[model samples]
Target chain A: MGTQAIRFVGYIFGAALLGLLALPVTSLVGAISVQKFLAGVYHPLFWPAISLSLRTTILSIGFVVLLGTPLAWWMAHQTSRIGRLTTVVVHLPIIMPPAVVGVALLQAFGRKGWFGTLLSAQGLNVSFTVAAVVIAQMTVAAPFYVQASIQAFKKISPDVWVVARSLGASPIEVFLRVGVPMAIPGLISGVLLAWARALGEFGATLVFAGNRVGHTQTLPLAIFYALESDIELALVFSLILVLVGLVVILVISQW
Target chain B: MVDTSLIVQVQVSLGDFMLDVDLSISMKGRLAVIGPNGSGKTTLLKTIVGSVYPDKGHILVGDRVLSDTKLRIEVPVEDRQVGYVPQDYTLFPHMNVINNVAFGLSTGGRRGSRACKKEIALRMLGRFGCQQIAYRPVQQLSGGERQQVALAQALVTEPRLLLLDEPLVALDMTSRRVVRLLLQNYLSQLDIPTVFTTHDVRDVVSLADSVIVLSRGKVVQMGTLEELQKQPCNDFLVEFLGQQ
Candidate 1:
């Protein structure tokens, strides 16, 4: 049997499966009881979660970028075993069970844990605060940024950076002007992907941030909150995630 | 007033491959570092340009003692003011020809004003007859144009010495002829010394004031191109010297 025919068949079957998956969502949106959705959209809890999600995810993504760029650059340039090991270690949260990430964050930051007691004594609490949510988001999302940035850096010829230095661009200038600009497409796409992952972080968010409505309750928490009683609110959160995710895809598509 | 002789001694280990070489050069004189790939030709360039630290060595250029393992004297690349044009004329793709050249005018030295930077770059471009492409992105340039932009960038800084690694590798035949003519003219007219690497004897015939041939990480011969051509000592020299 010619495999070309099988590949064509696979493409048709794959597209049909995709259409089937899309049908329910299309039908649901078409059959939306507008009153329920509109009312749910206006519901006081909904917008707050959206705002909180945006704030925390953006903050986490910001730090991820700030710390990740140099780390990725270092990993790309370094010729050491430690650098390789650190690269793998940084990716642990991605493969980790979500519940394990939550448990680990608590152990590391909880009062009896390593730095938690010190943080509490110093007049700041992270375990049940907005900061904790950002930390949780960062823990799981940072690897994406690091991986993408490293790949982006890899695409560039290291010799160009060497030329920049010889030509008088500082290390900082080289990173900002040459390195960053060249890697913009990969970095931007990765950041968006990280934001998407962070936006939906639930298990880690719940255990680490301790969902407090209007404080640390991100949209994912709100979805969980809504799922217990109000399916409409849950549907609204799900719809918002889908909308934002599509927007991310569109934005990244431009890059 | 100062010695321009560059005394370089360095060692680096890449797993089982180790590079240990001692080399030297002088100002107002051109030295060619010719060698096969992985024979440490590029490594010597990197070390001299301050991109890589030598496990052990001394690198002195002109009046400056840039690096010496014995004294642990190290001057960072930003302060070295050495102009380097790497292989492919690796011009910044995003920058126009003017900006690419202007990049050389900034080291740890007082950053020239934007107007000054542009002015300096333009002068160099004009000198090289590349003013017409001053506003074009280097990526859009022909190989020769890219080489011109890169060279113009390096020269605009008024560097102490030029460090070029295979400067002619990127050019097409026609463009290479034109660029080579311009480059040869510039080399003769300018007083500054330069060091460059190449696999082509044309580099020797056209621009090199003196030639330093390296075979397997060691200098096989050093002399004027005429002297080498007249007396081809080794098989490698005979084989290399006869090529087009």
Candidate 2:
């Protein structure tokens, strides 16, 4: 074939692949009309799940930023053995199945589990609670932020940090004013990715936090339950998810 | 006299190379560290500035001991009150020229209100003739402009000692001459001891009062430019100085 013909064939193959992947989600989009979706989405059960998901995901993102920012910053500066090791350990969640994370968290924090026994003594139970849901979300999502943050901090020249320090900026001032500002773009991207991961978290929340209504049922769990009860309700939830996912992707790409 | 004497004795092992140097400069001294590539000029400068710690010896600026391995006293870089401009300029890309110049003064060395800091930064930039570009981001600045801002940033804090790594090395011939004149004018006004590294002997002739020749991580010779030129201590000094 001529070069132009080969190019044409390549375009065709690319388009076909894109179409194949988008078909299922596109069909789900077509399955729900805005009017119908709006009518069904106002159900008593729907608002609670929506609020719970928003609350937990937002809180989980806050936790990730609070914990992950310092961790990533410390890890970035550390040349010690523990620092090097954590670089490898931080990515474990991204590769592990979400269900595995759910199980692992359960083993560590379940009522009868290691830390859970100690906590339970003080009348605290984390398992099958909204807090468990947030924990599961964080476990699966924090790595994305941490990994991105580490790379961001690494991209900065050591000279910049040194210059800042030598300029008489205290360590805390250097980090807050210089390091954080310089790495803001990457940090922002990391936050977006982590939020998306937390939003879609399913298997871990199901296993660890359970699928209880009004108490622990987030949007993803709500959708699953909707799927078993009414097809239209499930379609509405899926459409909302797809829309949220779309908005997030658009924002990150544009940013 | 400003009592700006700097006494340095430092030994640091970097990779397979070892750097050992002992030197002293009087107040208002302008020392040019001249050497070929990998001659440890930058390493020595960084050592004195507290970026690279010396395995042995101490650095004293005036009466204050910046680093004393024997006394187990090592001042933190932030507390050293040294202004440093790396070879690449190392301007914070995210900040504008005003903010970059204002960094050191606002952060720790001197405390001023935000408006006062901005006013000081503008005056510094005005001295460099770069006040027009005060709001432009560092990334958007030209090489000469960046160097100007970097120098302004270093000097605004009114550091006790200044360390500049190849401040004029990155500019073209015209800009280099312009910046050299600007630096010479400004540096002459400051009574503090200043140490700058350079590959160009012209820079040494115009900007430096004394020259330190480094080779293989050791000080080969130290003297005035004319003295070094008049008396060739070694072939390296003769060749290095003869190049100008």
Once fitted onto the true fold, the runs of candidate 1 whose alpha carbons sit more than 4 angstroms away are A8-35, B1-4, B9-12, B109-111
Candidate 1 clash pair list: B101-B153
Model 2: per-residue Cα lDDT at residue A247:
84
Instruction: Compute fnat per model.
Output: 0.72, 0.92
Clashing pairs in 2: none
At residue A143, what lDDT does model 1 achieve?
89
lDDT: which candidate is best? 2
Model 1 over residues A1-255: C-alpha lDDT tens digits? 589999999999999999998986776566557787788789998999999999999999999999988999888777689987897798899899877898899998977668898988897677888989999999999988889888888889988898887777788888887899888888998899888889889999899888899999999999999989988778877777777888987998898
lDDT for each residue of candidate 2 in B107-170, tens digit (9 for 90 to 100): 7647668999999999999989999999998889888898989989998888899999998988
**TM-score of model number 1:** 0.92
What is the C-alpha local distance difference test score of candidate 1? Answer: 0.82
Q: Which ten residues in a row have the lowest lDDT in candidate 2 chain B?
A: B103-112
